[model samples]
Target: MKETYGFKTVPITLRESYSASKNGWSALLLDDKNCKEPYRSKKYDIEIVDRVGGGDSFASGLIYGLLEKQNTKDVLEFAVAASCLKHSIPGDFNLVSIDEVEKLVKSGGSGRVER
Candidate 1:
């Protein structure tokens, strides 16, 4: 499909099994045809306050990153981080700002309280 469509990369979100400490989620990025390995984002530790709108948040973040001209890896990271954060908030809307999502991405989704 990628070859037929001439896509540069494809990003997929995987919902991992829950562990004793946290629920895990990851994003896989497949690049060009000759690429041997896909770039994988770090597993995000999700508390999962609400699962609704998680996918939407991820898609929105991906679009935002692409619109901002972020690199493939960065875009994947941003999307996954946004989705992770969405799981912690109640309701169907993702209320987080870009700064919050970027902070989560850079911090590796540690869930630390920011002062």
Candidate 2:
């Protein structure tokens, strides 16, 4: 798909809750460099205030990372972390800043965000 589509990287969501008891999500990044990086979000075990916009938040974070030209690892972590925090929010709109997401991504990042 990457070759045919000329995609530099392709991201696929991993909703662990669909298969397991844990309500968390992860992501898979298929890089054009023949690398498959799996990024699991931190901040799992959080009580979800709202279940809306998880995927959108994830995509936003990914976009932010890409726009900022961050590293792949950081990008994935940011995406998952952003989505994780978004779940704690009470609305479909995510209001978190770049700093907050970076903090979450930097500290104890890459695991799974529990809902």
Candidate 3:
């Protein structure tokens, strides 16, 4: 089907969660060799005034990474990083720049803290 559409196809897995105990949602980018983990996860952060559209933000970031032809690991990292940034902002748009996402990718989750 992908070849028919001329799209660089990727598989998407959706897990069903009926557990009210589940406090958050996440998405994982799957490829050969277990290349990445779930891209986003939130354990009920107290600061979030609005929970709507957060998943859309994650989807945006993942799609952005894929458009850049990022490797599975980088793609997952970018998505999660973007989602993290999304948490700090108040809007429908994630509003994170590609360079910022790249910085986080390069830092391997341990970037410097500049105040």
lDDT tens digits, residue span 16-114, model 1: 767633678888877563354688888866667788898999889888877774467787788888888888788999988889888887785565524
For model 1, give the 10-residue run with minimal summed lDDT: 106-115
Error of 3 at 53 (Å): 3.2
Give all candidates' CA lDDT scores.
0.77, 0.70, 0.52
Clashes of each: 0, 3, 0
Instruction: Report the number of the highest-TM-score candidate.
Output: 1
Q: List the residue pairs that clash in candidate 1.
A: none
Q: Which ten residues in a row have the lowest lDDT in candidate 2?
A: 38-47
Q: Estimate each model's TM-score.
A: 0.81, 0.75, 0.55
Candidate 2: list runs displaced more than 4 Å: 18-22, 33-43, 110-115
Candidate 2 per-residue C-alpha lDDT over 6-108 given as tens digits, one digit per residue, 9 for 90 to 100: 8878888766563323465667776544446544434354456687898899999888877774467777777888887887788898888878877777668
Cα lDDT tens digits, model 3, 37-65, are 33332222223434455577667877787
RMSD of 3: 6.4
Ranking by TM-score: 1, 2, 3
Q: Is candidate 2 or 3 superior in lDDT?
A: 2
